[model samples]
Target: MATAAVAGALGLLWDWLWSERFWLPHNVSWADLERPGVGNFPRARHVLSAFPLAAGIFSVRLLFERFIAKPCAIHLGIQESVPHQAQPNAILEKVYTSITKCPDGKRLEGLSKQLDWDVRKIQGWFRHRRNQDKPPTLTKFCESMWRFTFYLCIFCYGIRFLWSSPWFWDTRQCWHNYPYQDFLIMFVHHLATIGLITFSYINNMVRVGTLVMCLHDSSDFLLEAAKLANYAKYQRLCDTLFVVFSVIFVITRLGIYPFWVLNTTLFESWEIIGPYSSWWLFNGLLLVLQVLHIVWSYLIAQIACKALVRGKVSKDDRSDVESSSEEEDVPTGNKKCPYDGSSSNGANQVNGHMRNNCWAEE
Candidate 1:
């Protein structure tokens, strides 16, 4: 904790000493805060001198790099290995071989089952590959470009907000003839706008992706649950609720917010009233949408958890059946050959405890 505190203090000190040199005009000075548009630095000396604020900001970046990014990379690596690792199982191998030998509708169902992934996900991958073969889809490229622009805008706007304040500016005193309080407010407002847009975009993307994955999983659950008299109605209700709430959250996060931001009449009102007057209204709506999203996410997670638990229980039961029936099994030829029907002997090879299955005929 002490070390973290030290690191944070150092970070803030570093920001104080160098931030102005890099971000502010050379002509600006500490005295500029006394000007009309500038802010008062004298009043912020105590808070800016504290250790907590600096530590908090530095810790966030540290947490992202150390906890989030590393874990996400590991998860992605594991996911990438799934298809290769599962390739040797006879059922999986057959599905793989069929997919590689066919195209479009001919392979869709087999590939979908083999991959244990949604058809939409497989279609997306195929679309991405096809787009790679060409110049790339204009719409996708434009969206990516806009996303990059938005990220850049948010980053710079945040920096501006931090530096514009008297509390922050007093440390380095950058900016000439600018009042500290007013410019600080403007900077904060801009930061808020950028943050809102970035968050909205991310939420929209996650909501859409989640909804698609949920629909696929729900379909599978419905089919499986139909075989169990007690589970069918409950599963159907869960699926319906998930779809409905997910749609609502997506519409609010993506459609409403973007529409509000883009509307000329709204923009004019916001401009006339100023950010201070409109901040509460805008942020309030976002807060409500965020709450709805949280609720939707919770529902989805609950359904998934229940499904996973049931699947594990079913798998255990199947394993018991296989074990109990082992002594009564009929004699058969090589376990791999007739089941896989693979021309290549390589399909029978095992890596560790897993069988190899390829999505293509080798």
Candidate 2:
């Protein structure tokens, strides 16, 4: 369905560009091909114009797979790895280990240190167990952005086609010129825009799903980390934030309310009000919704950044401990332990003190 919409939109755009009188060789007639003119390469030009449309479709598909499908898989993989019936201590160990070994290894390290865990054990977990996959790379993210932008451009073209429709024009008391060439132009442009918007909307839905999954998976990790650290406060805070943002993300993306509102308004307008007035009101509401959507997106970004930073800090502290321990083990033969007198006892005391102090800080 999305493909068909996009194809239709692209076709409309192609016709519009060709038929509309503009800077680029205006008044080119598609019907003129049968007349055998001196400069007749209509078929060739038409075929050539399609290349960009085809490329645009392909690019959008590639991006959808990257940002949406792949991220969801990563989140699910992490969620599946959590042990359900494990001991609290065992769960902690597993959580810590998984954090270190997972693709978001830095975050795990920060989390371990924040929770006061043995970094070596975390490293061991990473070495012995495989993590789910990594999230999509920045390149993929950029690609997705580009694809969405392309869709937006196409959607604008669709707006132009829809705006010029006879139904709209007549109602608006605007000029109603439906010449064959112009009609063909409008039709092709509308087709392209519809196709692009359809593709974009589906991809956006997938992205929303992926984000929800990530929030879910992150919550589980935080819960286990909180348990290990006995920092119930932080855990609760994170959980609340995640849940709230996740809900917001899902609601805005699904656009359930806007759809209903639009439907209601359109129905009322069709029955009693005129088409022009109905369309104007609908467009106004759409603009408002678009603004709200942008604001929601910004909020989501802020929350995600906060979570990532918190996780990274915790992991970094864990790595610091492992480094300190390795330093202590370096043989300083006959040297007194830094914390006590007798060399052997001193070394043991120093190591113990280091571990205790680290855990106490947590």
Candidate 3:
């Protein structure tokens, strides 16, 4: 009974949140927007389709990874070597999960004294523990391949659809519509994207929403492709593609996105339609996305600086380091680690930190 009551209250809240008075302009009504003679506008019910679509995408991803991605990884000679596992320790496990993955020196000293183990042993144990959780190199390759394929296809589709769109050329047309974990950043980005998309769709702002998606899809595939190259130990190719991806990322995300997309939404829309409650909320989300862009761009700049100094894109900055000894134990040519730094000899070595290669937007 309590559950039902809570659900009922939540349902009412949702309905209240989507009230036409809140979402639509005072001069416009939901009924007027939904008129068949006016325009084909999105309804609240239409957003329900995302559920099945999400399920279908998941299923497709599994099949694609299993069949296509796995085979490609094998063909490219990406192999999985067993990583040394950390011994079970309840205290350490709790600390790793609830606290920091990498313990500070002071915490390490405390843990060492409490566990009656040397600091070096504890550090080694943490390294092995980190490796245990890090996905296998083959797994990473397959994941990147799947993402590359999906993003590339979507980008092409977006372009095809937007080619004839008026808003593609003139961003002002969108005002008429009125709309990573280790992947943590990517995770937040996905959530933000979903929020923006859902909010825009509910407000019948599909034109601007589509533009946002296209702009994002434009640069994502390149990053995935670079990861694939890095995984395959194609050092030169990986470095080159990383450079290209960085350039495109900066141009689309930092340059075009703010100047073109945000300008239209922030300045042009306000000028044309003025502000409303929903309008402020929508723009606020866009600004959130822009802030993320700036954060990522700073990270990419650091990576580029390191690459320039070293003359190659060696490792992913976001990756956690595993034990260096692990790579020493594995035979060369078969030792591939996810997010592992490439060795000077052009072999992708395990036991290095994983880089931040996966960035998703919708």
Candidate 4:
């Protein structure tokens, strides 16, 4: 207990020093209440304020899905065919853990020779072993549904709210707000979004910006819906939705977005706002978004080609595998985590373990 106390104190002190001295800009420390006064929040940490509302909404949605959506899905025969999942024994588990946790491209052929198994079997074990980290089908459903609901509502709200603003008529109002948000990658995405909205509003670029946001939101809605369908075992429906998603994503992101949005922000904005450093920052971030769009588009195309050939998609490539929503905007993350088969009794055990990565990879 005494050791723990000392360790805790040291850890806290290190955190304080690190955050205050190294993390903050100009070594600013949290030393004040920031002139507590009228129209300002109290000088107390109250980050909990937004959490409850979000929690309540989540709870209600979960409850509704439990009592409503899940039952409907079950009745309609929408279900995943869960084969008996297997767990690796300690020694084998250790091997898998080391490989996945910090892979160093150790030869699977050598591992296969060591285990007295085919290279394909070794590869299969590792693939499914890593897949074990994927989120379950139900969690994926709820997440996709939540995002679909949010983007749909936000798109509608953005349209309604911006219709009457002066920025709708003029191109210079967006410069007035000059909102500068500094955030990490995830928060940078949100900042970029707010930047897009604010600048579009300021520079009378709303006409193009609003359309881009709507197009993005629309594709997002379909993407999430497709994931929900995928989880529900509605392969046909999932395929249909994915096809539409691919089509719209291509049309909007590749065609309309690059042309319309880039023209307005990069070309037209320069004409109105004139040249500035921030313009480069703004357009640079926009290009970052475009790069992401193109990368995801490649995945979409990858799947589309498979669909054309096989009439359906049965698996995904590792490159597109997601561990969390931080890597993507729509309903994407780990899919169903598969595992290895159990060994048979005694001497024949190792020989009888399942030995195939049956799913085709292109």
Pairs of residues clashing in candidate 4 = 171-203, 171-204, 173-202, 174-202, 174-203
**Tens digits of per-residue lDDT for model 2 on 14-127?**
887544232111243335434654432223234344568767767866876567744643453422222112223565556646554333557667857776766645443443
Cα lDDT tens digits, model 3, 1-362, are: 99999999999998897786779766777778667677555556755656676777889999999999999999999876677878999999999888646588899999999999988688777778887876777888888888789889877877887788787899887676453001111221233345566666667666766677778777777778878888888877887777777678779878998999899989988887787778888888888888877877776666665666787776543333456666556654586643443422121221111122222343
How do the residues 1-362 of candidate 4 rate in per-residue lDDT, one tens digit apiece? Answer: 99999999999997864353332223223342233442222221232333565566678778866776666556656554332232464645777667573223366556666678655445455555555665555544555566666656665665565566554345344433222211121121222234444333332233445445545655666666766676666777877877787787778768877876676667755665465544565577678778867866676666665555767645322211433333234321353432211111111121111011000000
Residue 269 CA displacement from its true place in model 3, Å: 2.3
Error of 2 at 288 (Å): 18
Number of clashes recorded per candidate: 12, 26, 7, 5
TM-score (all chains, Cα) for each model: 0.21, 0.25, 0.77, 0.55
**What are the Cα lDDT values of the candidates?**
0.33, 0.36, 0.69, 0.50
Model 4 lDDT on a 0 to 1 scale: 0.50
- When 1 and 4 are scored with TM-score, the better candidate is 4
Better of 2 and 4 by lDDT: 4
lDDT of 1 by residue, 1-362 (tens): 99999999999997775343332224544445446654334322332333564466456645654465445434433111111112133643454355532246646777777768666455444433332333212222222233223334443544454444442323212212322323223322222223333222212211221122222222222222222211122344433433443444345434543353223223532443233322344345545544554554454444334444553211111111211223234342323221131221110111111111010000
Q: Which ten residues in a row have the lowest lDDT in candidate 2?
A: 353-362
Ranking by TM-score: 3, 4, 2, 1
- Taking all chains together, the TM-score of candidate 1 against the true structure is 0.21
Minimum summed lDDT over a 10-residue window in model 1 is located at: 353-362
| Distance from true location, Cα of 271 in model 4, Å | 2.3
